[model samples]
Target chain A: MFFNLKDFIAEQSEGETDWEIDLSPLLALMVTLIPVLLLQTSFATLKMIETTLPVLSDAEQKPEEKKKDEIDFNLSLFANKKSELVMELVVDNKRLKSVTIKPDGEKFDFIKLQEELFAVKKKYPKENRLKLMPGDGVPYDIIVKLIDSSRVTPEKKPMRFVSSTGENLETTFLFPDVVFGNITN
Target chain B: MSIVHDIVKKAQKDSGFTLQLTAMVDMFTIMIVFLLKSYDTSTLEVKNVDGLVLPSSITAAAPEEAMLMLVSKKGVFLNDKRLASIVDNKIEAKSLAKEDEDFIEPLFKELNIEAEKIEAIAKRNSTVKFKGTIFMQADKGLDYSVLRKVMYTATMAGYGDLRLAALDGEK
Candidate 1:
């Protein structure tokens, strides 16, 4: 029989074509990385609080004509390291009586601040802006807690308010817009 | 004895087993999908600095991509570079008042350079406007005064919009 080198080579090549590349190493890598990634992955959602430096606009400088029914309910909260909170209520650019609240033990009396804010909300339900002036020594956590306290009313009465996804919730609204003010001596 | 040997050989041949890999492949596919979905990489990547603990908040707004300023108990860093150190919860006097009044010099310089670059880009691309926004991640235990100075410095350097970074608090 004649030696058929071409036929032999063709058969060998055909056999080689049927074989698949080994994926065991790649599979091993995926297995290792998947678990590590899972361990490093965070389930907690990310959120943000938008703020702006106090910039006085020209329109703000020019005061509008005041009406009889209009009441300026601008409120400012001053927090100090001595666990003291001084809340000032301003009406039409005039400072009203200031209420000083001492802390209950170590923690700042957020409940008292809430009660005072709730009373202010009762008078001006449409007023949602608040100025938070934290002292130089006040910690960031307390400021965040104060902002949270100011954002919601203490009363659990059912009122109409929009949820995050545009759904209406039966909840009373409080001061949601916060303007961080300078700490004054 | 011959009959018993033949039966044993036939049983051995019948016992040749094959593994069913379809179930394993299905499980691996599900695991990969779940891991990919659970890992959220689409948001802005803010590197966690050492000795910095962020405050927790109930705000639902997601952070936008901007310049990063990390305020730790040790120092203040911008883009992983230390701008100034906090000595007794106060920035260096030179950085605070030497060149500019009340603004940190090093921070103002760095932020001004970045602002110029951003403004140049905005000028070239009409669609891109300079929002003058910056993201600040300060330590939870840091004094408000330090944060105030940082914010003031950023504002002076043309960063009007400030986004304070905080962890998501329990509802």
Candidate 2:
């Protein structure tokens, strides 16, 4: 009976007319909004994810420390028929030290060169890396042996080949400068 | 009146708003997804300087963004501007000397300016962080000593990251 009264009785105030509430349009509106809301929400979520990617932090160092780190000490080994081996430590274009390794017939004395190299290592206590540039005509096996000799101490760095094409060819950061030359047919 | 009420109810029930937008929303979603996926995160690929013959290398690598420093049979160029004559198995020091200032120092100053500008732009936009790889497109017949000095000069001018340009896939 109370439900009937509420349904039947129409209250009139300030010239208002009785009307039934229609939910169909509201339902349609909500249905339309679902996909838009989903899209916007997904876009916002993806944008947030992209922004949250971690950036690598650079190692902090003082100017003096950086300068010390940038001191490029390179040892260039030039082999000729006369001397057999000419080892020169080129510190920024100027030769800081040099040594001549004479071939003792069939045997090469690498241990003596290693001892001398160790002495030079103590000189530049900071960033004691020595980039090695071996000239052409040096045997492959000899180059490998020199590499082993250069690695006598953990402090002693490997060599890098200085090719005309500026490329870091080595997979590992050692043996700095090795020019790749073509074999003549 | 009952017929009119039925028509009104049907009209309200079938507003067509949701129906119209369903397909549009799907299309937009797919477009957005593809746009996000296909976007290249890397900066502009630097092209090697044209007309300059680069020394061939089996071990040379492809550089990222690079600044073109063309070394031709005629002269040394920093992106079209002639810097010096490379001849006689050596970089003629006389060729590098200007009115009073030295050639290498002036060249250094110019290169530094370019590098600083690039660095500044990179600072604001990280997508272009690699300022300029010094692309030494030196010719094959060029003197080795000249090439060596060019390498040294470019490296000393705050453009140490060197790149020798070459024909792709050619040894």
Q: Which numbered prediction scores highest in DockQ against the true structure?
A: 1
Query: How much of the true contact map at the interface does candidate 2 reproduce, as a fraction?
Result: 0.00
In angstroms, the error of model 1 at B38 is: 2.7
> Model 1: clashing residue pairs?
none
Clash pairs of candidate 2? Answer: A159-A175, A159-A176, A160-A175, A160-A176, A160-A177, A161-A176, A161-A177, A161-A178, A162-A177
A33-94 per-residue lDDT for model 2 (tens digits) = 55555543321110100001111235675565436446556765554423266567777778
Q: Write the per-residue lDDT of candidate 2 for residues B55-152, one digit (tens) a residue.
A: 33222343455566667666777766877765543455666645422235545666878878878889998886743356555555554345545554
TM-score of 1: 0.75
- The prediction achieving the highest TM-score against the true structure is 1
- The C-alpha lDDT values of all candidates are 0.75, 0.48
Error of 2 at A160 (Å): 21
lDDT of 1 by residue, B1-171 (tens): 344335544564688633333455567778878787768764455456777887888643677788788899889888789989888778777677755545788888998888788889999899888788888888889988888888777766767787888778864
